[model samples]
Target: MTETFTVTVEPLEREVECRADQPILDACLRAGVWLPHACTHGTCGTCKVEVLDGDVEHNDASDFALMEFERNEGKTLTCVATPTSDVIIEADVEVEEGVVHHPVQDFAGRLVSIEDVARQTRRLVIDLDREMAFNPGQYVTIEVPGTDATRTYSMANPPSEPGRIELQIRRTPGGLATDGWIFKDLGAGETLRLSGPYGRFFLREARTAPAILIGGGTGLAPLKSIVRHVLEGGLAHRLYLYQGARMQADLYDVDFFRGLEADHPEQFTYRPCLSDEEWDGPHGLVTDVVDADFPTCRKHMAYLCGPPPMVEAALKTLMRKRLFPRDIYREDFFDASDKATGGVRSPLLKA
Candidate 1:
C-alpha cells in the first residue's frame, strides 16, 4: 500500500504531496518544486527547513548541518526526512533573478567514454536521452548500476548546452566504484541512472563585486562550470581563480584555465598552486595564496569548492582577511568511499 502525505510551504501557500519512503526533497523535485540542497546525505545545511506541523522520521544526520537549537526549534534537513503523515514545512525558496536555472531531471544516460584527465582524475562523458536543463555549477547523483550506492558529481559542462553531461571523478583508494572500475575495466554503452541538477553553487549575476574562486583536486569541476558561465555571459568584473594540487601533474586542466585567462585578457586571472612541488607557479597551500593576494578581502565575493580540510582552512584565512562569512559560498566535496572505507572523516560532521 502506498501512503500519501501533504506538505504546506509557508508564505507561498504552496502544497505538495509526499510518497511513502521518499525523502521530502525528492518528493518536492518530483512535484517540480526546487529547493536549495547539497550533499543530499544530510551533510550540507542547504535543505534545512522548519517542520511547522506533523511528524517525520529522519536518519542520523550531522549535527553541524542542523544544530541542537535548530532541531529543537523544529528544524530538519528535508533531504533525509521522510514524512510520516500530513506535514507542513517552511523553507526559503526564492531563486534570485538572472541566475542559472536548475530543474530536477530523470534522464537515462549511457557512459560514452572515460579519459584520464590526471593520474587521480578521469573525465567521464555521458550521453543523456534528452537535454537536461541545469546551471553550470549544479551536480547530479550517479547511481551505480544494480547497486544502492550512488555518488554525487558536479557537472563540468556549460549550461548553454545540456544533452551531454561531463564529470571529473577522482579515484578514491578502496572506493567501490573507483576501485572496481580500476581493476575490472568498464566499456562503452553502460547505462546508469541519474537525477538532479541540484545545488545553489552557481554564479549570482546581480553581484558585480570582484570575485575569487578557490578549488582543490576534483573540486575544480564545479568552479570550471561557473567560470565558463561568467565568460559566456560577458560579465566584465575582475575574476581570480586559484586551483591547488599536490604536485604539477595533479593540476589537471591548467591549459583549459589558461585559455580562459588568455581569451578574457583584462577580466580574468589564473593562479595554479602546488602544495608540495619543486616547481613554482604559486607555492604553499591554496589558502596561503589567497591571504597573500587579498590582504583585505573587503569587497570580494569568494566561491570555494574542495576537500573539507581545504575548505575549512580557507574559511579561516578568509575570515582573518576580513571577509564577511556571508560573502563566502562553498561546496564541500565529500568522498563517499573515503568515509565508508575509513580513509577520511567529513569535517562538517566532525564539527
Candidate 2:
C-alpha cells in the first residue's frame, strides 16, 4: 500500500495529500493548485521549485534539466520528484485572467477511429467515458498499451465537444508511442487509459489583440482547438493561422480550414505553407509567410506550437516584428528523445 503524506505549499499555504510514489506537481494540480509546469516529465524544467523543507526522491529527472548542483542546493523538478516525507515547497503560481483552471483527472477512452490524415500523420477520434472540461490549447497524457510509458498530445477539438477527442499524431520511426503502439498494434475500438487537461498554452480571451497563430507538423492540433473556440463563439478579434509542412502531401485539413476562411473572411485568414517541396502555393516556412503578410505586430498576440527549432525561430520573428514576450505564448511539442537531451527552457514560457 502506498503511504500518503501531506505536502504544504508556500505563499498560498495550501496543502495537498500525495502518495509516496506520486509527483508533487501531480498532487498540486489534482488539488486545484495550479503550479507552473511544462513537459511534465522533468525534461523542460518548467516545474522546478525550491524544497524549503523535507526530502524527496528525484525520479527520472534529467541531469541537464535538474542540475546536480541545483539538487545539492535543495531545488527539485516537482514533476519528476516524489516526496519521501511531508514536504514544504515554493513554486511560482502564474495568475492569468480569462483562463479557467480544470483539475486533472483520469478517463477511460475508447478509440473509435483512426486514419491517415497526411504524410506520416494520423488522426484519431476517441470517445471518453465522460466529458472533460479543458481550455482551448491544453493537452492529455495517454498511457501506452502493454507498457508503463505514456505520450502527451494536444487536443484538436474544443471543450464544447466534450466526451469526444480528436488527436493528430505524427509518426516517429522506432518511437515508443508512435512506432511501438499507435502506428503499430493500436486499432479502432481499443480502450486506452488517459488523463487531462494538462498544459497552460490556452487562448487568453481577456486580451483584445488580434492573434497570430503559427503551427508546424502535428503542432496544428492545439491551434485547431483555439480556432474553433474563437470562431464558434464569434469572438471579435481577427485570426491569422499559418500551418507549415514539408510539402503539399504533408498537410491536412485544407478544405476544412478553407471553409472556415470562406465563412468568416473578415475574422479568419488561413495560410498553409510548404517548406521542402512546393508546387505554387505559399512556398517557404510558415513563419516566413507570416513575416511577409504582417509588416508589424505591435498590438497583437501570438500563439506558437511545433518543433523547438520552429518555435524558437517564430519567437525571434515575432519579437522582431514588435510583439512583446508577454504577448506571445508557446508550447513546444517535446518527445522521449527530447527528454534524453534536455533543451533550454524559460520560466516565462507556458510549456
Candidate 3:
C-alpha cells in the first residue's frame, strides 16, 4: 500500500490527506481547503507556508522559490513540497464558514468563436458541456491536443450565464501553446478538455467599501469579470478600473468599459493608461496613473492583476496610499514563462 500522510493546518484547525507522491497544495485543493496559491510549479512564491512539525521535501521547487534563510526558518513552498511524514503547517486560510468551494473537475467544452481584440490578444468564447459554477475571477486550464501543453486564461465574463465561458488570450512570441495551437491550428467547433474553476482572486461579497480594479495587458480578463459582477448586481459601492497597455493598439474592450462608466457615472470610472506611446488621456504606468489620481486609499479595497513586476509596484504604491495589506488582493499573470516552457501557467489565470 502507498503510504499516505496527513497535513494539519493552523488557525483554521483543519486536516487534509496527502499522498506520498503528490504536492501538498494539490492535496489541499483535492480536499477543498482553498489555501491561497498561484503557480503550481514553484515559480511563484504565492504558496509559501511555514512547516511547524513533521517533515516534507521540496525536491521540485526552484532555488529562486525558497532561499536558504527561509528554509532555515522552516518555510516551504506548498506547490513543490511533498510530505515525507504527517505534517503541520501554517498557511493563509481562504475558506469561510458557510461558503463552499467547488473542487476542481474535468469538463468537456467546444470553441464557439475567436475574435482578434488587440494586436496580440484574442477573445475566445467557449460553450461547456457541464454547468461549471465558478466565481467571477476564476479561470480554467485548457488542454491543447497534438502537443503536450496547456494555457491558463481567466474568464472575462461573469457566471451570470451557465455553460458559457469567455477568455482573453495574449499571444506569446514563441509560445508552444499560443503559437502552435491557439493561434494557428485551433478552430471553432473543436472539442477541448478543461479542469479548474480555480483561483482566489474573486471579489469579496462582504466588502462594502469602494473597489479599485487595476490591470495590465490581458490581465484585464479577471478584473472584467469582477466589474461585470459588480455592475450586474447593482452594487452602490464605487468602482474604478485602471487598464494599462503599451500603446493604443494594445488596448481592447474600451467601449464596453466606457459604456459601463457612462451608465453608472456616479458609481463607476474607467481609466486607460499608456506606457510606451504618447497619449492624451492617462500617461505612464498604471501605478503612476493611480498615484496621480488617488492620493490616499485608506477606505478602499484594491484588486490588481498584471505582470509580476507591475503588480508588485502597484501594490507598493497602493500600500503607500494608505491601503492595508489585508485590503489588497492581486493576481499576477505568468504567461510568458509558463507558455514558452510548455508548463502549466499559474493558477492565478485559472481562478
Task: Give all candidates' CA lDDT scores.
Answer: 0.80, 0.90, 0.82
Quality of model 2 by C-alpha lDDT: 0.90
Error of 1 at 264 (Å): 1.5
Give the poorly placed runs of model 3, Cα more than 4 Å off. 1-21, 50-59, 68-74, 83-90, 94-100, 144-150, 335-351
- CA RMSD for every model? 3.0, 1.4, 4.3
Give the poorly placed runs of model 1, Cα more than 4 Å off: 63-73, 92-97, 181-184, 337-351
Please report the candidate that would top lDDT against the real structure: 2
Which regions of candidate 2 are displaced past 4 Å?
344-351
Residue-level lDDT of model 3, residues 287-312, one tens digit each, is: 99999999799999999987777887
Model 1, clash count?
0
Q: After superposition, how far is residue 36 of candidate 2 from its true place, in Å?
A: 0.9
Which ten-residue region of model 2 has the weakest summed lDDT?
342-351
Question: What order do candidates take by lDDT, descending?
Answer: 2, 3, 1
Q: Candidate 1 residues 75-112, lDDT tens each?
A: 88888888898988888787666775555768888889
